[model samples]
Target: MAQTEQRAAPAAPAGHSVTAVAARMRELRASWPPADGVAVFNNVYLTVTEEVGRNIGRRRFPDRRGAATLDAVFAERYLAAVDAVAAGRRPPACWRPLFQYRHHPGVRPLQFALAGINAHIGHDLALAVTDACRLLDCEPAALEGDFHRVGDILERLEERIREELMPGPDLLEIVDPLTHLIGSWSLERAREAAWSAARILWGLRELPGLAEEFRDGMDASAGLVGRYLLTPLR
Candidate 1:
């Protein structure tokens, strides 16, 4: 079940320099135990962020500033969620499941990565887009292309993660619950949901009450799915 609605906190901090964001991630990585679920997800995210930064530096993204800002803003939300958990506060509904089950012995690394992806993409991405719009003074449509481009990078990374982290073929039998879990999620679907939520949140921006309601609904729904994804399977 989703937790009670959180007081509206600013989704992204103002003028959060990318350098500061990177430093925060590194600090978290260094501080957390490697086996902790949040740390596992953080490691994967840090790699992706590093790659995105390198790509931005190389003029890879057509709208470098937009991509960079979006990435930074998006990352800050995740880090904030991490900090909330570490501080013994309730995080957003979308994140509570992951923290609840982070250290469960039956949950594998792949599950940890995917659960984090689910919570981040399903809940955080939409807010991040809105946060980016506020910072960039642009519409969500303007950021659509950049979003897809980043999604493509994420898809490739997901494939690589599966190849590198999945248990050996011999152990992953058709009867394995892991196989079913893996089959149940799609990066494509998560991206589509994020896009839809972004538009909805943007449309409701003027109606703070309605926007907060919608955001909470999205958060609860994502949390529910995340809980399913994190189901212990040994």
Candidate 2:
């Protein structure tokens, strides 16, 4: 289910709201020289590549768009922390923690949750890359996907979430997400699966536990071919 709406509280002390920050990115995008764009692209490629490698071929990347969203969310327009400080408001984005316990002053639990969802958007891109790498044993590098597959993957996860029947290693002997897929994902297919997982997590199902088991199993099975079809890309 989506989040409930929030009441208008005392105007937030300062830098706040994903909306506020998104505004700034627009401004930057407007002025950035054409040539400079390559830098942004390169940075994304480098980071994504590194993360993919670090995860040992696993598909846990923040989507390129999601990463950009983070940049936007914290931009001066949205939550411009520095400007807010100068203007006697507050500050903008930082790498505190993905999850927080408070919703007062600025960071609303709802907003935080929203950010979490948004953050996972990037996972799709990474997911795609990971999938390709796993199957091909090399980067898909430039493959993309169509929407129907993405939609289907999400639909299944949704069914699992709504029914609260996400399979588990304990009862069904079903695998966790890390090893969930049977083989390397085509970049497109992986992205879809990833996107669905991202959205489903917000529903607060038993995803984390399943994720953990997947994580553990993958961690143990890095770089070795095994019975599991999707062995976390290592």
The top-ranked prediction according to TM-score is 1
Query: What is the C-alpha lDDT profile of model 2 across 8-37, one tens digit per residue?
Result: 112222333233333443444455442242
Clashes of each: 0, 12
Q: What would the per-residue lDDT of candidate 1 be over residues 7-126, giving only the tens digit for each residue?
A: 211223467555567778899899889999888888888888877766666667788788888988999899889889778999999999899999999998888889899999999999
Q: How high is each candidate's TM-score? A: 0.91, 0.21
Give, for candidate 2, the lowest lDDT window spanning 10 residues: 1-10
Q: Which structure among the candidates has the greatest lDDT?
A: 1
Off by over 4 Å in 1: 1-14
